[model samples]
Target chain A: MKLISVKLSPLNSKKNKLKFSVTVTLKKDVLDPQGKVVQNTLKNLGMHDLKNIRQGKFFEIEINEKDEKLAQEKVNEMCKKLLVNLIIEDYKINILK
Target chain B: MRSSVIVFPGSNCDRDIAVALQKMQFKNKMVWHKETALPKSDLIIIPGGFSYGDYLRSGAIAGKSLIIEEVVKAAKFGSLVLGICNGFQILTETGLLKGTLLRNKNLKFINKDVHIKVINNTTKFTSKYKLNQILKLNIAHNEGNFFTDNDHLKELNNDNLIAFKYSDEKGNTSNLSNPNGALDNIAGIFNDKKNILGMMPHPERMVDNLISNKDGVNLFSSLLG
Candidate 1:
C-alpha cells in the first residue's frame, strides 16, 4: 500500500493542471458608458453610497501545462493576442491553482 | 478594379457592398471569413455587420477570423482596404487602424442620414470629391464614438490623415454636428500610408439614386480612377 501511494503521488504531480483567471477592464482614460448607466440605475434604486462603477469582463482559463511559469506565460500571450484589447482595456491575470 | 468584400458570419451588408461595387464596374467577389486566401484584388472591403453577433465586443471575434490574416497581408502589400461601420470596428480590433469605437455617448443606437465633410481628398478613396465637400451619408451604429490616446490624436491631425468629419450642411464641424461623439467630429480616417480607410458611415447604402441619393457614387468613382 505504501508503494502504490508513492506511485500515484508522482502521477498526480505530473498531470497537475494550472488554472488562471483574467480580469479585463477599460483603461482609466476610456469611458465606460454601460457602467455609467448601471451606476445611474443603482443610484435611482436607492444605492446612494455608490460613488462609481466600472464595467469589465472576466475570463477563467485552465491550461494543460504542468509548469506554473509556462502556464502563466501562455495565459499572458492569450490575453495580449485575443482575450483583451490592449488599446482600450487592461487585464490582470491571477493564478487559481 | 478588382475588389473583394470579406463576408463573415452574421454579416448583413455583404450583398449591399457587392451590389455597389458591381454598379461601379468593379469585378467584386464575396470572400468567406473561413477562407485562408483572398482573391487577387486591388481593393478589399470589410463590410458592415454584427460579426459573431457582436460577442466579446463588436468585431472582436471577426477581427481574429481566418480571412483577416489574408486581409492584413494584402494591406501590407499596399492594397486599398476599406472598413465601414462594424467593419470599422474590426479594423481597430485588428490593429490595422489606430483607435477604437466606443459606445455612443448617449448610449443609444443612432441610425440616420448625417452630413460628413471631406477632410482630405488626395487619397484614391476620396480623389473624386472636392476638398471640404459635405456629403450626406447613412450612419447606423451603436458604437461609433471614436476614441484614441492624445498622442495618436495629435499624429492624426499633424499628418492630415483625417478623411471625413461630421459637419452641418454648410460644412461647420461643431459639437452640435457631432452625431456619435467621435473625437474631433471624425467620421472617417486614413492610415499614414493613405491605403487604408475605416469609417462608420455606410457609403454603399447611398450609391443608388432610386433607393437613396448619389452622394456615395464619388467614393466608388474615385477608387475606380
Candidate 2:
C-alpha cells in the first residue's frame, strides 16, 4: 500500500463535513493554448524572459472518509473517474501531511 | 408572430438567424444595439458572435448595452427570447439567466458538430422533440463552459430549466461530452418562466438539408405552428 500524504481542509461544514482539495493538470503531451496566449501577451509587454507556460485545473474536492488511507484512495479514484480527463490530463496528489 | 433579432456591432450570426426566421415566414426585424426600444415582438433573438469583441469577459460589456434594457422589459411582459452562443453568454451577463460561462476546460476555441440530447422538451424552443432524443448541431466557442453554485444548479434541475445536454452517439457523458467541450455538457437552457431559450449550438447554421442537417427547422416550425 502506498503511504498517503494528506492535506486536510474543511470543504463544507454541515452535520457531516467533506474534506477536499486536489490539483489536476493537463498531460504533458496536450497543448495549452490559453497559457500560450498569456505568454505571448507577457512577451509583447517586454517580459521576454519566462518559460514553460502551461495551464492546469485547480479542483477543491469535498468527500467523506474518516481514515486517511481511505480518503487518499477515494480522492485518487475521483481523479481517475471525473476530476481529470485521462486522455488529456495528468494529475498529482498533494496531501496536507 | 412578430420577431426581432438583436444585433450588436460584432454579431456575425444575426443575419443567419434572420434568414432562418425568413424561411419560417416570420416577420423578423433586426434591432440594433443602440436602440432604446424593440419593435413590438413576442419573440426576440440575440444571435452569436464576438459582441464587443468579447472584451473584459465573454459577454460582460455587451450586457450593459442600451438595447438590452428593452429586452429586459419585453421579457418581463412574458415575451419569448432566444440567445445562441455568444448570445447565451450575454444573457448570463445580463442576469436573464443564472450562471456564467467560463473558459473551456481545455482552454481552446473549439468548433465542431456535436450531438445534443433534448433533456426537457416542454419549453417553447424544444417542444418539437421528444425527451432524451439526440439532435445534431454545430458548436463554436471558447467561453462556453457553464458554471454555477450548487444551489443554483439544483434549482435549475428542479425547475426543469435545463433544455439540452450534450452527449456522444452512445449517450455517455463526462468531460468527453463537449465535442466543443462545454461544461456539464449543457447545450441549452430556458428561464424559470420557460420563455427564454439560450443555447450554444447554432440552430440557424443547420437549417438547409443540402448545406447542413435540417434538424433546426423543426424548432422554428414548432414555435410558429
Candidate 3:
C-alpha cells in the first residue's frame, strides 16, 4: 500500500496562506484487510522481511487563514468534522506555509 | 401508519423497501437525500445499496449529506429509524448507532441467507418475534463485520441493546453461525432508546411470498401496528 508521504516545511511567513495537510489512518485495533492482502502479495514476491501493512488516506487541504495558530485550529476542526471517523480512525494535521 | 425512505444517489434498495412498506399498508413516501426536511412520518428508513458508490468508506459520504441532519432530528424525537445493509453502515457513520463495519474477516463479499436470533424483542423493530426466535434473512455485503471496543460491547450487553444475533436454525449462537465475523455474533443493534435499528440483513427482500417467503413481513407489521 502506498502511504501518503508529506514533507512539512516550517511556517515562515504570517501573510502567506498555509497549506494544511491531514493524514487519516485507521485505528491500530481496526482490521485492515486490503493492507494485509498487499502485504501478502509482497511477501509472495520475495520481500520476506515484510511483517505487516496498514492502509489509510491523506488529504492536502487549503485554508484561507493567514495566522498560523488560526489555520491550525481550522484544520483541526476539518479533521474532526469530516476528514476522519474517530471510531475506527485517527488523524494527524500538519500546517505548512 | 406513515413512513418515509430516504433515497440517496446510487441507492438501489429504496424502491424495494418502499414496496415493502406499501404492502404492509403504510403510507410511504420516497424522500430524496437533498431535501432539507422530511415529510411528517411515523418511521424513516435508510434502505440498502451503495450510496455515493461507497467512496471514502461505505456510507461516510452520505452520512454528511444535509438530509442526514433531518434524519438525526427525526431519530431523536422518537420517530423510528430502520437501517438495512448500507443503511446500517450509514447509521453507524452518523453516530445514530454505535460501532463500525469492517471488511469481512474472510475478505470476500458475502451474499446468502442466514438465520438470526431475535435478541431483544422488546425493541420496536423486533417486538413481533419472541426472544431468541430464529429468523432466516438474507445478508449481502462486503463490509459487514461488526466491531466495537470492549467497553462498548460490555455496555451494549448490559443495556440489552443488541437487537439480533446470528444463530443456527435451532437458535444456537456460535462462532460458526457468524457469517461476517461480527462481535458476539451481533447481526443487528439498537440505540440506547431503542428507536433506531441498524442491521446488515435485507428484511425488505424477504417481505414477499412470491420471492421466496414472507419471513420479514412481521418486522414491517410490527412497525405498522
Candidate 4:
C-alpha cells in the first residue's frame, strides 16, 4: 500500500475578509415618486441639463470567505434572499476587495 | 378563535391589535419577532408600525425576521394571516402577497381617515361585510401606494383577488377617492388562496366606538364566524 502525504498552505489557515457593495434600484416599470421629487428639486437648483435622477440604496457588506468567486456568489444569494425585493427592485453586486 | 400578533422592535401597533383582538372575544397572544416558533394560532395579525425604523425600505428588514418564517409557514398551511399598513408592506416584502407599496405620490406621510370599499366579501376576512360595502378606516403611512406589474395586475383582476379599493362613501372607486396613488385605487388584496390579506388601512384602530367608529368590528366578527 502506498502512503500519500497532504500539505496545508498558510493561505488556507488565514481567513480572508472580502468586501462587496450592493446597489438596489427600483425597476424601470415601477414608478419612483421619491426619485421624481428629488429630480425635480435638483432641476430647480440650477441643474436644468439633468435629464433625470433615480434614487437607490447602497450596502457595503464584508464576508469571511477564501475564494473570491464564492464570496460573490454568497453576496448574490444575500441580495436575492433579503437585500432585494424582486417584485419592484433590482440589484447589482460588485466586489470592493 | 385564537390569534397571534407579531411584535417587532418598532411595532408600536402591537398592543393596539392585541387589545382589538381581545375585545373581539378572541384569545390573543403577543409574539416577539425573535421567537422562531408560533403558538398554534388560527389567525396571525401583523399590525401596522415602522418595523426596523423602515430600514433599507419599508418592511424590508422586518420581512426577514425569525418569526416571519413561521408566519409564512402558517399562512401556507391555510391559516388566516392579516397584514395592516406596515404589516402589508412586510407581507409584500416576504412575497406572501405580490406587489409592493411605493411612497405616496405626493411624497407625504398621510395620517387620516380613508374610505375603502370591500370589493369581495366572500373571503374568511370579509365574510361579514356586504359586497361593495364602504368602510371608513384610518390610514397612516408614507408608503401606502400599492403597485404591481401589469401581468400580476391582470391576474389579480382575473382571479378577483382584490379585497378592497379606495372608494367614496357611495362605494364609487375613482382616482379622486384614492388617498394614495395606489394602482387601480387598490387598498388591499388577498393571496391566491384568499387566506392571506394585506391592507394599508388600520382596521384595529377603528374598532373602539368611544375612540373611533365600529366599522372595523365586522372584520373581527367575520373571522369569529
Candidate 5:
C-alpha cells in the first residue's frame, strides 16, 4: 500500500542552478547477457584483452539548488524513487557543480 | 464473475483477455489507463503488451499512469488483481508485487509456449487445478526474468505466495526447464495478502479450443469458480 515517494529539492534562495549526474547500472548479481554477448563478439573480433563488459544506463540531471548537501540528498532520493530500479540496478550520483 | 481489465495505450492483450473472460461468461469491463476509478469487480486484470512502448524500463511509464492509483486502492481493499507479462512488470513497478522482472538471460525476445508447473494451487488463481499440474501457456517478452534479493526471497517462501514455476512436460522444475532464466525459475507470484497475482505467461492466449490446446482454460475457470 506504499505510494511512490516524490522528493523535492529545496529551492536555491539565491536562484542558482545545481549540476549533478546520475548513472544507473545493473547490479553485479543480476546477469547482463547483452553485455556478455558484446564481450564475446569483441573477443571473436580479436579483442582478447577485455575481461568483462556490463551494459547500463546513465543520466545527467540538473536542478535549481544552492546548497550542495540538499542537492545531493534530493538527487539521491530521485535515483531511489524513480531514476533507478534498486531491485536490479545500482545507481551512482555525482555532484558535478 | 465481475472483472475489469485495465488497458493502457500500448496494451495489445487486453482484448484477448477480454474475449477469454467473456468465453467464461465473465462480466468483463475494459477500463482505460486515463480512467480514474475502477468499476466494481471480483477481479482486476492488467493484460500484457508494451505499455508506453516499454520506454524508461518495461513497465515504469505505465506504472505511474493515472489508472494505477485506482488499482492500488482496489488492491488494498482486497480485490483480486492479476497481471500478465507486461502487466506483471507494471505490478512490480507500482510496488503492488515484490521484486522486478529483469531482461532475459539470453537477451532475446522469446516467443513460444512453455510449460509452467503449478507450485501452489490453493489460491483463487489456481484452485481449479491440482497442485504441481503442468500447463502450457504463451510467454512472449524480452524481460521476463524475475529478480529479488535473498532476504526478500526468504520472506516470499515464508509467505507461500509463489504460484508458478517454469517447468517441463512432466512438471520437473530446474535450470534447463526455465524459459526466461527467472530467479528460482519463478513464472508467477502472488502478493503477500494472496490477492494480487503477477506472471509472465499469457494464459488467455491458450484458453481457446480453436487453438487446439486448451490447457489455460482452467485458470479462468478457477477465477470464475
Candidate 6:
C-alpha cells in the first residue's frame, strides 16, 4: 500500500480549482507573446518592480495508494500523459508522504 | 437539406464528414477549394485536413483561399457551418471563430477516445442533448490546443457562445482532464447567433456503432431539425 499527495497552483484558474498549487511553466525556447504583452502592461501600470515574467501553469494532485513507488509511477504517468506538455512545457514534481 | 463539404487540397478527413452527412440522408457535395461559390445548401462543413501542409502555422496558409471568401459570405447569410479538427483550425484562421489553435502542449500526435461535456445545448448542432451531459468521441491531432484572451473568453462565456467542453470518463468538466489543454475544455463552440460551430473532435468518425460510437449523429440530426 502507498499514499501520494499532489498540489496544483492557481495560475490557470479557468479549469483548475483556486486552491491547488501546481507549477507548470513554459519551456525556454517557446514563444510567449502573451507574457510580453502583460509585461508591457505592468510597466505601464507603474509596477516597475516586475521583470522577466514568463508564464506557465501550476497544479496540485492528491493520490491515495499504499505503495510509494507505485504511486510515484502513477503520478509520473499522469504528468507525461496529461499534465505536463513535454513539447513546450517542463514540469517538476513534489511529493508528500 | 443538401450539404456540402469544402475540400481543401490537404484535407484528410473530408471523406469522413462527407460519409457522416450522407448517412444522415443529406445530399453531400464535395466542393473543391478553388470553387468560387458553394453549392446551394442549408449547411456547409469544412472537414479536417492539413491544409497547405500546415506550412507557416496550422491554418495560416489556408486563410487566403478564394473559397474562404464565399464560405464567409454563406455563413453571414445564415447558412450553418461546421468545422472539425483541421476544419476548426481553419475557422480560426478565417476569423469566423474566435481564438487560435496552437501546438499541442505535449507536441505529439495524440489519438484517443475522450469524453465531452455538452455546454450549450441551445444551438442547432447541440440542441439534441442536455447541458453537462458527457459523450465519448475520438480525438486525433497535434495542434488542437485552444487559446483566447481573458476578456474574449469572458465575453464568449457570457454570450452563451461556448458549445462543448472536454471532460473525463466520469463526465467531469475539470481543467485537469483537458487532453489538449483547451480553454474551458472547449471541444466545440457556436457563433453569436448560433449558426456556425467548430470543434476539434471528429464527430464524423463516430457515426457507426459497429466501428465507433454514435454519440455524434445527433449533432447532424439536430441540424436537420
Best by TM-score: 1
Give the better candidate number (3 or 5) by DockQ.
5
lDDT per residue as tens, model 4, B46-134: 98999999988899999999999999999999999999999999999999999999999888999999899998999999999999999
Enumerate the candidates' DockQ scores in order.
Answer: 0.67, 0.07, 0.47, 0.65, 0.55, 0.02
- TM-score of chain A for the candidates in order shown: 0.85, 0.70, 0.79, 0.83, 0.80, 0.64
Q: Which of candidates 4 and 5 reaches a greater TM-score?
A: 4
Question: Candidate 6 residues B1-225, lDDT tens each?
Answer: 999888888999988888888899998899998999789989989888889898745766676688889999999999999999988888877878877776676656789999898888888898888888888889999888887767768988999888888888777877778987777788887877789998998988889999988998988898888
The model with the greater TM-score, 4 or 6, is 4
Tell me what TM-score chain B of candidate 3 gets against the true chain B.
Answer: 0.98
lDDT of 1 by residue, A1-97 (tens): 9999998997786567889999999998888988999999999999999999999999999888988899999999999988888889999999984
Residue B93 alpha-carbon offset, candidate 6, angstroms: 0.7
> How does candidate 2 score on lDDT?
0.80
Residue-wise C-alpha lDDT for candidate 1, range B1-225, written one tens digit per residue:
999999988889999999999989999999999999999999999999899999988999999999999999899999999999999999999999999999998899999999999999999999999999999999999999999989989999999999999999999999999999999999998888999999999999999889989999999999999
Docking class of 2: incorrect
Interface CA RMSD of each prediction in angstroms:
1.0, 11.8, 1.3, 1.1, 1.0, 12.7
Clash tally, candidates in order = 0, 7, 0, 0, 0, 22
Q: Considering summed lDDT, which 10 consecutive residues are worst modelled in model 1 chain B?
A: B5-14
DockQ pick, better of 1 and 6: 1
Candidate 5 lDDT at B156 equals 77
Model 3, B35-83: lDDT tens digits are 9989998999999999999998899999999999999998999999999
Positional deviation of residue B171's Cα in model 3 after best superposition, in angstroms: 2.3
Tens digit per residue, CA lDDT, model 2, A1-97 = 2233222223322313346677766556445567778888888888868876777767676665556667778889977644554444577776553
CAPRI class of candidate 1: medium
Local accuracy of candidate 5 as per-residue lDDT tens digits, A1-97: 2232222223323347778888888999888888989899999999999898988888887887777889889999888777799888998888774
